[model samples]
Target: IKTAVEKIDIDVPNWTFVAARLFLFDLYHRVGKSTHGIKGEPYCHLKEYLKYGKEAGRLIPNLGEGYDLDDLNDYIDSDRDLLFNYLGIKTLYDRYLIKNKEGNPIELPQHMFMAIAMFLAQNEENKQQRAKEFYDVVSKFEVMLATPTLSNARTNRHQLSSCYIGSSPDNIEGIFDGYKEMALLSKYGGGIGWDWNQIRALGGMIDDHKSAAGGTVPFLKITNDIAIAVDQLGTRKVAIA
Candidate 1:
């Protein structure tokens, strides 16, 4: 992987694909040894993979239960794995694929895309067809999903929205509640847009007791800490605005 990555330059940018293939080879070998002992073929047992993810608590318990495993497995086109370049596949491997408690990836890029499609289309009238359509566009790189949707769609966390917007009112309870809400949302891969303009400026009066407020900077510092502490389950740091 190091050799292939070093070979990539402006003159030979396609080496990224070579590096991706090498990394994928290593990933497949690791997953196979850890799971089914079948190297070079990561998509061989779709049903078993889903079951293992559920048992490991990386995936929702009901994942793959409503679909025909045989059909879904057949629908998975391993050829689509070729669509991803190095950075794309690496990002998916690092952040999106479901990992066990031991922090090893249990699903491949195609598996992640298929799982997202299945979870999203599970409630449709013709769910099997809808799932196929979703898989087709996503795996082929014809559409892009938001970060949270890509990361949490098939996982037990399942908070698939991109971001949330809310206001922090100008009261003690409301300020703390806003902080708590941001923490919870960040825990599940959601970005936050908080309206803190209502907070008093520096040295403002607090109430009838003639207490002085420390202003929004102190509250903003708390939010900054929350962003660092709750880092979206290690996928990425929280984004706050």
Candidate 2:
């Protein structure tokens, strides 16, 4: 794969593209004429794959009965497929490509890349131009979106970003309220930001002792601990943005 990537002189820097391409090449070699429901006669096997994808919350759209295999298979980009290198295709198939129940890849490597680009594009009017830019960035690995964002964006779920922000007030009740909000947001694997300025300083309030109140830090610590306890998606660290 390294040797193959070194051979191609495309205007890109990253090895991810090369790897993805290689993965696709291998897949094609292994199963060139494998009849997938979305690509051939609407086989039960392919339908099962598509069903599994939907059940797993994958962004792949289900092609109903009317959208036969011929229609789905017709949506091909042979030209784009040619652009993939050995490594680029392999990496895509291994890590990024969507697969069926039997572990056969449903979407091609180039198609996956195209889908990502489409999802990241600016808007309808400039979609083509912006999609090109997005493709370039992703193919070159200049910038990669978060896993969830990449996985779910531009589809029905359309929650494109990986993070969110919130603010808490100064008073005790307000502070707890803010924590509650943060907790809820964190449930969705979202990051949160809170301002502790409104919170009063410790030891200084309650009437007087205006000299030193220690301020906001304790509440901040408590929030941090709660975040730690709750955690983010069991994988990503809970973070304050």
Candidate 3:
């Protein structure tokens, strides 16, 4: 990236585009390694990658079980890599691209789009055509899925959809229960918006014993900690609450 940036500064304007290509290079290497144990070489039979992922249970649990992965290679259009701008491609490579155990991206730009499309069209009667249509919609920048769909679709532990916003009434048990729920959602890379309006103000008195309640601030304090505890893919430093 440093080298890519330096090239960008030194009058190689196309280096901005080249940076995404560099990321594509990394992705191809990862696929090569995963499918054939050979870095920097593409799999001669690309479907083997999906086959291996399913066999190893590293992809969507029952990926292409009834459908066919062979159609994937036929569907993927690598020319779409040119469609991305610098920031668009950078965001994908950094935050959304699926990675292998070694932290290498296994999906190319087209492959990622197709993976998401296939996952969405798995139950369709004509899956390949439906997947292709979906891929065309997204790859052409005509429409895009939610962040979670970009991040988790076709993944082994898919938690697709962007965020969760639900709440519970305020109380000792409710506050703690909300915390537990928030923590679980955050654990799976969700941004939760919990309603805390029902809680009393600072130093508010409890109705039962007339004791001073710590109020909403005290209850919300642990939220930051819980978010930190279960970071999103270890990228987002804390949960968005």
Candidate 4:
């Protein structure tokens, strides 16, 4: 996956846009960790297939070569077996498990989850505890975030989709301000929920009665057009609802 990302061609604007979307939002949230050891909780738990391999009489190739014995033992120990439930185990294999270039599973469930947990908890002072807390939260149903939030929280891509507000008055400058907010939201891959209702209805008194107001629908169409023009890298979308 790392190789795929490195070699991915970003020349096509649309492709690049989509890649940017996933890179900042989807992939980051989904990936527990990279082999390079950057802590990311979102992508951490994508490694359950390796255990399946052991059950099939296949040892993870090159289990211990350059690593410390204690580290290897800690990583390879069967304690990870206790982390997941039956359904989570099955889902990990079916959807989330990442594989090597040769299609061999390179991730284990605990490693993957811990990697993602760490990524999400990167802001915490004690990363290990934060990662473990994240893992505990995700392991159960106490709290859950959307797929995009889950994918991109603590990475280089600060693609957090929550709320977008556009403040427009009755004048052109107000319209521009709203448009600017929309553009900013698009850049950050956030869904915009504009309160166009605040915009005065057409032919209504506004701005100390110097000018008439444009109705909500016309400005609504204009706002909609603005959204259409500025695409949000595909990770988030702007809609009326």
Number of the top-ranking candidate, with TM-score as the measure? 1
TM-score of each: 0.94, 0.51, 0.83, 0.48
Q: Lowest summed lDDT over 10 consecutive residues: which window, candidate 4?
A: 63-72
lDDT of 2 by residue, 57-105 (tens): 4544632333333333334344465455565455445655665456665
How do the residues 126-194 of candidate 1 rate in per-residue lDDT, one tens digit apiece? 898899999999988889899899988998777989889989989999999888899999999898898
Tell me the tens digit of each residue's lDDT in model 4 across 14-105: 44333333433333333333233245433232233333333433323322223233432243323433444334444454444444444444
Query: What lDDT is reached at residue 106 by model 1?
Result: 77
**Residue 2 error for model 4, in Å?**
26
List RMSD in Å for every model shown: 1.5, 7.2, 2.9, 14.4
lDDT, ranked from best to worst:
1, 3, 2, 4
Instruction: Sort the predicted structures by TM-score, highest score first.
Output: 1, 3, 2, 4
C-alpha lDDT of all candidate models, in order: 0.85, 0.56, 0.71, 0.49
Candidate 2 has what TM-score? Answer: 0.51
